[model samples]
Target: MPKTGVLIETENGGVKAINYGLLTAAMGNKENEVIAFITQNDAAEAKDDLAAYGVSKVVQLKVGSGDINSSPDLCARALAAAVEEFELDHIAGLATAPGRDIFGRLGAILDVPLVSDIQSIDYGAETAVKSHFSGKTMATVKLEGSPVVFTVRPNAVDPVENPVDAETAEFNADVADGPKVTVKEVKASQQDKMELTEAPVIITGGRPIGAPDNYKMLDECAEVLGAAVGASRASVDAGFAPHSMQVGQTGKTVSPNLYIACGVSGAVQHFAGMKTSKVIVAINNDKDAPIFEKCDYGIIGDMFEVVPVLTEVLKASEEK
Candidate 1:
C-alpha cells in the first residue's frame, strides 16, 4: 500500500470540515495508507476527527522550542523533512491560501512536481483531473515522482468516513529557520465573511442587484440558510459588490453544496467559477437567460419579489 501523507488544515483550533474531503481524495481506492500531518494543534484533540476519516497515523511536526508560526519557509522545510522521514509515497492538502503557499514551497524544497486545484485524483494511475479554460474542459494530468504533491480544491470531493484508530507521534525537524522573512503580525479578515471556497452553501447576486445595499436582501436570505454571499464579475464591475465577493474566471472559485444565483445571467465566465457546485439554483427574470440552460433548477421571476418570499418561507420553516 502506498503511504500517503495529508497536510491537515485547521480553523478555530480544530480541524476544518473541508480537510476531511482531502482525506477522502487521498484515500482514493482505499488501499493507500493515510497519514495526517499537523502543526500547532493538539494531536489528542485532532486524532479522533482524523481517525474517523481513515487516517492511520497522526504525526505532529514541530520545529523548535518556539512556535514556527512566523516562518513559512521553515515550516515547508520541516514538512519536507517529515515527508522524507516517513517515506511517504504521495502527499496532499487543500488548495487554500496558506496551503498553496506552504505546498508550493514544499514542492520547491523537495524538487518535485506539485499539482494544484485538482478536482479528483486516481492515485493508482498517478493521474489527477483538473478543470481548465474556466471549467470548459477537464484535463487529466499524470504526476511523475517518488512522492508526488497534490493540492485539492476545497469541497471538490465529498468526505467519506472509514473510522480507524490513528496512532500519534511527534517529529522535531532539526532545520534552521533562515532570517529571510519573519511574519511580524498576522491580521485576519475583519469581516465575518465565510470563506468562499469552504462554504457549504452560497447565495450570489448579479448585475441586476442594482446597488451594494441591495445585497442586504441576499444577506437576509443567506443568514437563514447559513450561507455566504457571492457576486458575479458584472456586479463587481458595476460597483454593486466588492471584488472580494466576486465569483468568476477572474475571481474566486467555489464548490459549495448549494449555489443560489440570484439575478445572475450565467455567463460562461461566472459559470466557470461555480460549475462544480453540487446543486445550482438560478433565479432570473429573463426566461431566456443562459443560466437556465446550465442550472439544476431555474426560476423565472424578479429577484426582488422572489427573494423576500423565499427568506420568509425559510424563516417560517425554521420557526416551525
Candidate 2:
C-alpha cells in the first residue's frame, strides 16, 4: 500500500474538525496507508481523534533549531525531511492560509508538482479535481512524480469514520530556519469568529443590510447556528461591511453545507463563490428576485422582519 501522509492542522492543542475531511480524502479506497503528521506539540492528544478517521500513525514533526510555526520555510523543510524519512508517496493538507504557504514552500524545496485548492483526489491515479475560471469550470490535474503534494479545500470531502489502533511517533528534523523571513505575530480580526471558508454554515447579508450595526442580526442568527457571518460585495462596497467579510468572485470562495443569503441579488459573481453550497436559502422581500431561481429555498419577506423571527425560533428550539 502507498504511504499517504496527511498534514494535520490543530487548534487549541486539538485537531481541527476540517482535518477529518482531509483524512477522508487521504483514506481513498482504503488502498493507501494513511499517516497523520502534526507540527504541534500535542500529537498524543490528537492521536485518538485522528485514529478514529482511519489514521494508522500519528507523527509529531519538530525542527531541531527553531519552531516550525514561526518559519514557513523551516516547516516546509521539516515536512520534506519527514517525507523522505517515512517514504511518503503522497502528502495532503487543508488549503488554508498556512497550508498554502507551507505546501508551496515544500513543493519548491522538493521540486515536485503541487496541486492546490483541490476538491477531490484519486490517490491511486495521482489525480486531483479543482475549480478554475472563477469556479466556472473544474479541471482534473494529474501529477507525474513519486511523491504527490497537494492541498485540499476545507470541507470539500465528507469525513467517514474508519477507526484504527494508531501508533504515535516523533520526528525531529535537523533543519535550519530561513534567515530572511519569520512570522512575528499573528493577529485575528475577531478571535471568536469562525473562519468563513471552513465554516459548514454561513449567513450572509447584502446591500439592504443598511449599516454595519445591522450585521448584529446576522451575528445573532449565526451564533445560534454555529455559523460564520458573511457580506455581499454590494454591502462591502457600500461601506456597510468590510472587505474581509465579502463573498464573491473577487472575495473569498466558500462551499458550505448550508448558505443563507438575505437581500442578495443572484449575481453571477456571488453565485460563483457559493454555488457549490449543498443547500442555499434566500430571504428577500421581492418574490421576483433573481436569487429565488438559484436558491434551494426562498422566503419572500422583509429580512428585518423575517430574521428576528428566525432567530427567536432557533433560540426557542435550542432552549427546548
Candidate 3:
C-alpha cells in the first residue's frame, strides 16, 4: 500500500474538506497515511477535521494576502515541498476548480502523471480505478514512481469521521518568488440563504420546473425537509435560479446528506456535483431521465404535483 498525502485547499470553503467524500475514503484505507497541508488562512478552523480524518501531520503555510485558489504556483510548490520532505508516495485532493489549477502546476513541477477526478481509489501492489473520459471509462493506473498526485471527485466517496491523533507542524514553506496573477479584489458571492455546498440537505430544481415562480413548490419541499434549495445549470442558465444555487463543475460542488431533485433531467454535469450524497431522491416527469439512474430512489411524475405531496408527507412525518 502507498502512503497518501492529502492537501486541503483553503480560505473560501474550509467546509470543502468535510464535504468531499475522500476524507473518509482515505481514512478507511488501512495502509494509506493521510496528511494535510492547510493554508494559513484556514489553519485554525479546518485543522481538527483533518486530524479526525487521520491526518498524520498538518502543515501550515502563510499565503500572505493573496487568494490560495488563485495562487496555483504557490499552492503547488507548498504541497510538492511537503511530498518531497515526507517522501510521500501518493498525494490526493478534491477535484474542485482550485484543485484542478493546483493539480496542473503540481503535476508539471513534480514531473509525475496526475490521475484526477477519480470515483474510486484502491491501493494494491500499485493499481487503482479512476473514472475519467466523462465517467464512461475507467483507467487502471499503476503509480510507477513516487508522489503520484490524485484529484478525486467530491461526493464520489463517503466521508467518514475517522479520528486520529493529529500533529500540527508549522513550517515555512517555499513560495514562488513571483506570482503570475494578482488578486485586486476578492468578492465573496452574496446570497441571503445558505450556501448550497454547506447545506446538509439540498433540493435541486432542473429544467422542467417551467419557471422561477415554480420554485415555490420546490422551496416548500425544501422547507418541509429542512434543506437548502439548489438548481441545475440548465435551470440557472434559464434564469430560473441564481448561479450560487447551481450544482455542477462550473458551479459549487455539494455533498449534502439528503438531495432531492425536482424536474431534473439528470445530466452528467448535474450529477457530478450531487452523486456523492448519502441519499438521493429524484422526482422527474420522465422515467428515462438520466438522474433516475444515479438516485437511490426515484419518482416518475411532474415535480409540480409530486413535490407538494412530498412536502405534505414530509411535514407530517416530521410532526409524528
Q: Which sections of candidate 2 miss by over 4 Å?
A: 177-179
TM-score, one value per model: 0.96, 0.97, 0.78
lDDT of 2 by residue, 1-320 (tens): 99999899888877899999999998898888999888875888998999999999999898887787888888888899999999999988889988999999988889989998999988667688999988899999996666889899998899999999999999999885453569888887864788899999999999999999999999999999999999999999999988888898999889899999999998999998998888999999999999999889999999999999999999999999
User: What are the C-alpha RMSDs, in order, of all predicted structures?
Assistant: 1.5, 1.3, 4.0
Candidate 3 lDDT trough over 10 residues, lowest sum? 11-20
TM-score comparison, 2 vs 3, better candidate: 2
Judge candidate 3 at residue 63 and give its lDDT. 48
> What is the per-residue lDDT of model 1 for residues 1-320, given as tens digits with 9 covering 90 to 100?
88999989877899999999999999987989999988868877899999999999998988865566667787788888888899999988899988998899889988989998999998767799998788889999998777899899999999999998889998888776463567888887757788888899999999999998999999899999999999999999998888888898999999999999999998999988999999999999999999999999988999999999999999999999
Summing lDDT over every window of 10 consecutive residues in candidate 1, give the lowest-scoring window.
173-182
Per-residue error (Å), model 3, residue 278: 6.4
Model 3 Cα displacement at 233 (Å)? 5.3
Cα-lDDT of candidate 1: 0.90
Q: Candidate 2: lDDT over CA atoms? A: 0.90
What TM-score should be assigned to candidate 3?
A: 0.78
Candidate that would win on TM-score: 2
Q: Per-residue CA lDDT of candidate 3, range 1-320, in tens?
A: 45677777554556464333666655546677776777745555666767776667777754444545456777777778778777788887877666778888889888888887766766754665665444345688875556778877665676666777777776565565756755456676654565576567999888887788887777777777768899899899999888878987677767678898888887777776666678999888888988787789999998878888988998888899
